[model samples]
Target: MLDWLIIGGGIHGTHAALRLTAQAGVAADRVRLLDPQPSLLARWTQCTGNVQMPFLRSPVVHHIGLSAFELFEFSRTPEGKRFAAFAPPYDRPAYALFQAHCHHLLTQHRLPELHIQSKAVGLHRMGERGWRVETPAGGLDARRVVLALGLSDQPAYPAWTAALASSGAPVRHVFDPNFRAAELGDWQQAVVFGGGISAAQLALALAARQPGTVTLLLPHPLRIHQFDSDPGWLGPKYMRAFEAERSLDRRRRMIREARHRGSVPKDVAQNLRLAAQRRELRLCEAQVLDAQPTDAHRIQLHLSPGDSLETDCLLLATGFDGRRPGGAWLDAAVATYELPIAPCGYPVVSRALRWARGLYVMGPLAELELGPTARNIAGARKAADRLAQVAERRRTGHQVTAA
Candidate 1:
C-alpha cells in the first residue's frame, strides 16, 4: 500500500509529489509516481530544444520554490542559472533559464519517487478512504491520487482530417508519433496547419530543417497577435475578475478569449516571413477543407477557395479539444461508489482540491476552483497551498471530508 499515487509525472506531478510527501509525513520510498516516460518532461523536449526563447511568458517570481525568491537566488549560482541574466528590471526569465532551473530542481530533489515506467490502466475506489490504481504492473493501493496529464499528447484533429485522409494522399497531424521531420526525404512542399505557439514553433522548426519550404495555413484573416492576452492574467488584476464570475459559462467564455495558445512570437513570425520572401515558405489564410493521400503517398489538400494544393505531407498542429477528468481510464477505474462529477466533466470538489475520500485533482481539472490558469505552472503553487492547508488541518485531526 502506498501513501500517495500521482499519475502523469510531469511538472505538476513533480511539485504535487513533493508537496504530498511533505503533507502525508511519508518518505520518498512510501510515495509512488506513475508516468509512462523514464524521465520528467519527456513530452516537452521539442518545445524547449536548443531554441533561443527570449523570455518566458510567465513571471520569474512564479516558480517551484518554497519561497518566491528561491529560483532567483538559485539563479545566481553556477548550476543555478543556465541563461544570461535578465537585463534590468524585467520580471521574466529567459525560457532557457527556466528549463535549466527545472532540470536543476528535479535533479536536486531526486524526485519521481517509485517511478513506474508503465502507463496507467485505470483507477477505482478501494476501501473506505483509499484508491486502488490499476496499471501495467497490477493494482497498487493508494491513500491519495493526483492527475498531472497534459494537453500536448492529445492533439485535436478536425473531423475533416479523416475525410481528407480518404483522399489520395493522407494528411498527418504534428503530434503523430510516426510523424518525423527528419525523414521528409525529397518532399519539398508541405502544408502546416494551426495558429498557436506550437504551430508557429513547429513551422519554424520545419522551415529550419529543410532546404525547401512549408506553408502555414490559418483560419484567422491575419497573423494572430503575440502574447495575445495580458500578462496580468497571471496575477490578480484579471484573475480576480475571472474568479468573481458566478457562472461557469461566463468563466469558460473568458477562458476562450484569454487562452491565446497558438499565437507566434515576433521572432518566429520574422523567420516565417524571411522564409516566404526567400521563396522558402508561404503564409496563407486558407482553411483545410479536406485532405487525402495520393498514390505516391503525398497529401492532397483541398482548400476552401475551390483550389487544390498537393504537398508531400500535411501536418495539423491544432491544439487539444476540451479535456477534463474522466476519459477511458476514468470510465474503467471509477466505480459506482465515487463522488458524482459535475456536468462539465471535472470532479466536483471543495476549495481544497479534493474530489473524494482520498482522491484529489491538481492540474487542469482544478479549473473550476483556480480559474483559467489552472493548467499553468503557477497554478501548481496555488494547488500546493490549498492542499497543504488541508493537510495541516488533517494533521491536527480535522478530518476534512467530501461535500
Candidate 2:
C-alpha cells in the first residue's frame, strides 16, 4: 500500500505531489500519481498547443512550485530571462516559460518516477485500512487518496452540437482528444464558436495560418477581464465572506456570479481587435440555433434573431461543462461509496476537500469551498495548501501510516 495516491496527474495532482514530498515532508516513494496520460500535463500541453496561446492569463505566483516566488526567482536567471514577458502588476509568463518552469520542476523532483500511467476507473474504501483504486492495468491500495481531477477532460458541447456531429461535416470541439489543428488541410473558411479566450486564440491561429479564413462566432460580444476572477478571492477578503455564507446553495450562486463568464484577457482582446482591423478575422455576435450539412462537405449554421453562415470547418471553443466532472468513473465511485453530490453534479467536499476520511478532492470538485478560482491553476495552489495541512496532521496523528 502506498501512503498517498493522487488521481489525475495534471496541474493539481502534480502540485499536490510536490507539496507532499517537498514541503509537507511526505516521502516521494510513498506517493503515487495516477493519470491516463503517458506523461504529466499531456492534455494541458495539447490543449494550449492546439490554440497556439501566447502568454498565460495567470500571474507568476501561480505555478507548480512549492514557493510563491519560485517562478519569479527563476525569471531572473539568464536562461529564464528569455521567458519573461510581463505586462506589469501581473507578471504573465509566456506559455513557453511556464511550460519550461513546469518541466524544470518535474526534472528536478524526478516526478516521472512517481507517476502511474493508468486510468482510475474505480475506487472503493477498504474499511479501516485505506482505499483501493482500480485501473485497467491493475489495482493500487493507498492509506490516503486525493482526487485532484481538474477540468481537462470535460468539454462543453451545446445541445445543437449533436446534430452537427451526426451531419458528418467538419465539426470538432477544440478540446476533442482526437482532433489536432495541425491535421487540418486547406480550407477556404473556418468558424470558431464561443466567446472565451480559447475561441479568440483559435480564431487568431486559423487567421494567421490562412489569412481572412476565420470567423469567430460569438453568442454575445466579448467581455474583457485581466484575470479569470478578482484577485480578492485568492486571499481572505473574498474567501472570508464566501466561507461565511454557510449555505452551499448560496456559495454555488456566488461562484457563478464571481466568474468572468465567456471573457478574454486584455491582450487577447487587443490582438483580436488587430486581427479584425486586418480583415484576417471576422467577429460576429450570433447564437447557433441549428446546424445542417451541405453537399459540399461543409456546415451551415442557422443563427438566432435570423441569419445564417456557412463554413468549411467548425471549432467549438465553448469551454468545459462544469456540471459534470469525472463522468462514469465519478458516477461509479458515488454509487459504490455513497458520496454526496451537489445539485450541480459536483462532489460535496469538506473544508480540507475531504470526501471521506483518507479520501479527498481538489480542483473543480472543490469549487463550493474554493470558490470561482477552483478550476484554475491558482485554485490548484489553494487546494495544495489545504490538503497539505490535512495530510501533515493525519501523518502526525498516525491516522494514515506509510506502507
Per-candidate local distance difference test: 0.68, 0.86
What is the C-alpha lDDT profile of model 2 across 298-378, one tens digit per residue? 988999889999998889998887765776877887988788887777777777788877788888888988998988999
Identify the candidate with maximal lDDT: 2
- Alpha-carbon RMSD to native, per candidate: 3.4, 2.4
Q: How far does residue 220 in candidate 2 sit from its true spot (Å)?
A: 0.2
Pairs clashing within candidate 2: none
Model 2: worst 10 consecutive residues (lDDT sum)? 394-403
* TM-score of every candidate: 0.85, 0.95
Model 1 per-residue lDDT tens digits across residues 1-403: 7767888777677777667565445567767788777676665544334222456655677666556777688788887555746522346677667778777777766774467777777787877768888888898788777776666566688877765655545466666545554455545687778876666666666766764567878766444554546567767888888878777667677876787666765655776778778866677877668666666567777888887778876777786667764467775544465555555666556777877778777777777767667777777888877776665566667866541
Task: List candidate 1 segments past 4 Å from native.
Answer: 22-26, 46-56, 62-66, 70-74, 80-82, 85-95, 164-170, 177-186, 222-229, 266-271, 332-335, 396-403
Report lDDT (Cα) of residue 17, candidate 2.
95
